[model samples]
Each structure stands twice: as C-alpha cells, then as structure tokens.
Target: MFKKKYLALVLLPLLLLLLAISFLGQAGATTSSKSSAPLAAGVQDIVDRGVLRVGVKQDLPNFGYRDPENMQYTGMEIEIAKKVAAELGVKIEFTPVTAQTRGALLDNGQLDMVIATFTITDERKELYNFTTPYYTDAVGFLVRKDSKIASNWEALDGMTIGVTQGSIQWGLLEEIAAEKGIHFNFRELGSNSEVVVALAARRVDAFSIDQSILSAFLGKSNQLLDIQYKPSEYGIVTKKSNTELANYLDQLVQNWNKDGSLQTIYNKFGLTPVTEISD
Candidate 1:
C-alpha cells in the first residue's frame, strides 16, 4: 500500500510534466507561426516607434490650416490626423509641408503618411500609395472680393495668377491660359498662405487651389469660379512600398463611413461637401 501511494505521487508529477510539455509545444507552434507570417512593416514601424509621423499643410484653413491665435494645428485635416493616430494606438507628430515637399517627405520615410489634402492621381500613384479617398476636392479660383476678375476670364487677360507649387492646378492654369490665348503671369508659390498673400498684395490677381481651401477664404475672397477642372480626390498618402499601411488606412476609412464617424467629424467643423468613402 505504501509502494502504491509513492508510485501514484510520482506518476502524477510525470503526467503533469507531460501535459505541460504538450501545452508548451502547441504554444511554441503558435508563436512560430505568428513569427513566420508576414509582418505589416509600415504599421509595425509606427507601433514599435510609438509615434505616427504625418505630413500636413500649415495654411489652407478648414483643411489643414494652423490656428494663428494659439499657433496650434487645428483643422479638418488636423482632426483627421488626430483620429488616425488614435486609431493606430500611437502619438502623432505633424510635420508642416507644402505641396512640393509633401510627397518627398513620405518618400524619404520622414512621414508615415500625408493628410495634407493630397490628391490621388495616376501620376502620383507610381510615386506613392493612396488610401481610398475620404473626400473630393475640386479646383477653384479665389479672387479678392473687390477684384475685377471675379468670375470670367475676360477683363483680366494680362493679370498675374498665384498657385501653390506642386498643386495640380499649378502649371495647368498657365497651360490652359496659354492654350486659350489668355496670357497671364503665373506665380507658383511654396504654400497656400503665400498664394493668398500674393493675391492680397496684388502680386497675383487670382489664387487657384482646392475648393475646400477656397471655402476658408469665403468672407475675405469671392470663390468666383468653382470649376471642377480636375476632380481631385483627397487621399491619405503613404510610401509607395507601404501597401500594408495603405490597406489598413483604407479599412479604417471604410469603417469610419459605416459608423457615421466621418460625417460627425465633418459636422463638427461645419464643413460642406463632406465626402463619403467607398469600400
């Protein structure tokens, strides 16, 4: 009987050891499988670093403009950046960039993404990956409320026009003017504020940019021409090779649409022409 008792005790420990070994083997397999699976490098990079660096505009109010009063970034795009960082479970560091530098910022890994009213285009796609667009921004002209070139091309044939460098309408405005035999001096500036300042100082008669930006200057300037010359879809821009991050952002946009969160964000800012994203 004493022998039986000793044997039982020994066997119980052996059985427990075997069970533990089996469980550990299964756990090891799971760990191995997960380790071997493809890692979302872009997302993982943000997670590992605990920060999501984003490129954004410094001017262009209502979209990505900064508050001069508090000197803090707070606009529709800024809010969107905040939401994206919150969703990614990380902190966001906003780097101010102009149209010319935004793509380059993302290309050199300086920014995880660009939410600076980046328009998705075929030419741009080869250089960057764009998530499903969150909104559509059209081309528009902003002339001073008292300017003579309010709407039409006539009566301002030789005036200077201001456009942001690297903006879709930058060269196109001049190109169209040349083609139409409406000669005008074209000034491509570094930022939207520069363009607006040029117009204010009479350095440029008209300022052309995205309509959403033109909306911000509503009371000060007349959006005389809301031409959808190039229907620009505002998309989140990422590195060309970072499709995984792009996909995640696409999914995030879809979910935002489904949950009405996107509309809420638009409503909070009292913005019109709120964009609806598709899956």
Candidate 2:
C-alpha cells in the first residue's frame, strides 16, 4: 500500500508538469496569433478579397467630387483614401455616400471605410471612432467686402447669420452665440454654395464655415473682404468598434502631420496650413 501511494504521488507531479507545459504552449500560440494579426482587419479583409470599398461624397468640392471631365472621383479626401489603400496594398472601389448614408453604410459593412470630410464631434464619437485631426479649420463669418456687420463673434449681435444646414458650422455658431449671451438671427441655407451665393447676393448678412474652406473660396473669388475664424479642427471618422483601424489612422495622421503631408495637401488647393488648434 505504501509503495503504491508513493508511486501515485510521483506520477501526480509528472501529470501536473505536463499540464503546465501544455498550458504554456497554448499561451505562446495565442500570443503569436495576436502578434501576427493584421493591423486593420477590415482593411485586411478587403485586401484578401482583392478590393477596398471606400465611401466618399460626390458633391463636396475639394474634399470629394466627381471630375466632370473624366467622371472619376478626386479630391483631398480621395487622395487620403488612396494613401490608405496603398498602405494596405489594395485596389480602391469608391461608392457614392452622402452624410446621411455614411454611418449606415459603415455600420452595415457596405463600405470598408469613409474618407469623406467628416467632422468629429462628441455626438458622433458615440457611434464612431475618430482619428487624429487631418485638417484644421474654424467657424468663420464670411461677409461681403463692403458689408458693415461685425466680423467677430462678440461684435455681431442681433444680426441675421446664415450657415449651411446640418453642419457643425451652424451648430457651433449657435453654441458660441448662446455661450456669449448674444442673440443671432440664424438662417439655415440648403447648402454651402447656396450660403455663399446668399452672402454675395445680399440675401444674408454673413456665412459661417471652416476657415480653410472659407479662405479657399475667397481666394478663388476674391469676394471676402472681412473674415473672422473661431478656432476649430477636423478629424477622420470611423466606426467605434473599429478601434484598431482608428488607432492606425490616428498614427498615420500624426505621421502625415509630422512629414508635412497635411500642409502639402492644403497647399495643393491654395489654402494656408493650420497647426495646433486643440492639440
């Protein structure tokens, strides 16, 4: 009986030793798999399937627009999407998406990613992850060169202001005015271009948009005599569950900022570079 008990004790230790080795091996395998996982699963899936599905706007000028000459989508946002595809080693397939469908498309997996000029907001951050800022601009009050309305936020009170409907610019303008205890007569325009035309035709006293966009428009038309920008910035949008992809994009944006890629894009379209709005 004693001999049997001793043998059993020895064999029990051996069994435990083997079990420990097996656990260690399984842990190592798991670690290896994790380390070897693709950087962006969505991107990898698209690459493996031999296509990169991107959602882009067909009307936003300088961001995403179809070229009338060739009917090919092209712009700063398109260029950024191309860069991401090049990094992932995939062919890009763009699908026309408006602001309304952008979230749903990404949610349903119809689009791998969206490179549209999507503004990051706390409200949007609930459903989507936002990368580091790709471009920076602010809400600017655009008035005719000869208009006498106040250009600055504090200076304008009880004056009718115009902004594009469903835009951050419109929201920010209202928020800032409320915070400052100023009342603004606000008009929601159908589109950004319409806001500009309204300002030019004296339909509205002012128009609000990002500084870079406002600058580009004024630079092209030479119509802006007085422009005042209230500090803000832009960011890339992605689904919140896509944390890995979001981090990758944020890193890429930081690298791009460091390497002057952002500035280069701005310069290509004849706009001034912006740095360090929110940091």
Candidate 3:
C-alpha cells in the first residue's frame, strides 16, 4: 500500500510536468508564427511570384506618366520602380492608379509597391510602410498665365482653388491658413488632370498639386505659390505587413543615393531631388 502511494505521488508530478511542457511548446509555436509571419508569408510571396507589381500614376508628369508618343510608361518614378525590380531580379508590372486607389491597392496586395508620388503621413503609415523619402516636393499652383494674383500663399485668400480629390492637398490650405485667417473656396476634382483642366477652363482660379507635376503645366499655366503646408516627400510604399521587403527596398534606395544612381535618374528626368536618404 505504501509503494502504491509513493508511485502515485511520483507519477502525478511527472504528468503535471508533461502537461506544462506541452502547453509551453504550443505557446512558443504560436509566438514564433505570429512574430515571423510577415517575413515568412509576405516576403515569400514576392519571391514566389517572380514579379513585383507596383502602382504608379499615369498622368503626373516628370514623375510617373505614359509617354503619349509610344504609350510606354516612363518617368522618374518609373525608373525608380525599374531599379527596384532589377535589384530584386524580378520583372515589374506597372498598375496605373489614382490618388484614391493607390493606398487601397497596395494594402489589398493587388499592388506590391507604390511609387506614385506617395507621401508618407502618420495616418498612411498605419496602413503601410514607406521607404526613406526619395524627394521633398512642395505644393504649388497652376494658375492662368495672365492672372493678377501674386505668386505666393498670401494671395490665396478668397480665391477659388482646385484640388484633386483624396489628395494630400485636401484641407491643407485651410490648415495653413488657420493662423493667417485666410479662407478660400474649394473645387475638388477626381484627378490631377481634372484639376488642371478646371484651371484652364476657368472653372477654378488655381490648381493645386505637387511642384514636380506643376512644372509640366508651365507652358499652359503659371506655377505659383509653392506651399509646404502638408508633407510633400515622395516615398516608395509597401503593405504594412511587408516589413522585410520594405527594409530591403530601403537599403537599396540608400545604396542608390550613395552611389549617385538616384542623381542620374533625377538628372535624366529634369528633376532636382530636393531630399536625400540622409535627411
């Protein structure tokens, strides 16, 4: 009877130990899977797919645009996308997107990366990861060449301004004017092209967009009032879940800046890269 009791005590502790070990093993597995998920799933998918699908703009000139002559995509942003794909040893498939769809497409995995003048904002960072800024552009106006308004932000008071819908420029004028007591009427269009058209058709007094894009309309409209109201840095973006790829791409961008590859691309596109990796 004593032997039976001693055996029961020893085996009870051993069984409890076994059960604890089992629980701990399962917990460790769950942690490992959760922690390494992005690397294992998101990064692997890029490699298995053998192609990087990037969302870029089709209308913004000097950045991403379709060459009207040959209908081929070409610009500073396109070149940057190409360089990333080349480094990844993968083919690039460009998907044209507007300001409204760029974030959604990237988040949904319909597009692997986005380089369509994507600005990094804290709000957007919650949805995706962005590389170090490639350029720091500013918002500028495309106004009628003969307009009497001064070429500065102070001139925007009581003006009818046009902006692209879902663009970063939304609320920017009002936000900046918060301290200046400036107020203006807004005409929100669906796209940058539409905003330019609105400016030309006299539907809006001035069109607001990035200075890089405004440069393309210099022949038809006067560039005025470079505004830094909102962040204007352009960045390469990937899914928030795609941390590994974002890290890898950031390294590539840093190396490109160090080696002057970025300078060459900017010079080719007639753009002055205002920001750098160091900044």
lDDT of each: 0.79, 0.73, 0.81
Candidate 1's residue-wise lDDT over 24-106, tens digit each? 99999999999865548878888889999999888777677777798789777888889988987899898998878887888
For 1-279, candidate 2 gives per-residue lDDT tens digits of 999999999999999999999999999999999997665674556668877788887776777788779999867888888888887787889998765678899898787678776777888889888888787655566676676555455567777777765566666667777788988787887766777888778778777766655554674333542444455556777776877777877888899889988778877665554543421
Clashing residue pair totals per candidate (backbone < 3 A): 0, 0, 0
Inter-residue clash pairs, candidate 1: none
Q: How does residue 121 of candidate 3 score in lDDT?
A: 84
Q: Arrange candidates by TM-score, highest first: which order? A: 3, 1, 2
List ranges where model 2 is wrong by over 4 Å. 1-37, 219-222, 225-229, 276-279
On lDDT, who's better, 1 or 2? 1
Specify the poorest-scoring 10-residue window by lDDT in model 3: 270-279
Candidate maximizing lDDT: 3
The model with the greatest TM-score is 3
Worst window of 10 by summed lDDT in candidate 1: 270-279
Report the number of backbone clashes for model 1. 0
Cα shift from native, residue 182, model 3 (Å): 1.2
Error of 1 at 141 (Å): 0.7
Clash total of candidate 3? 0
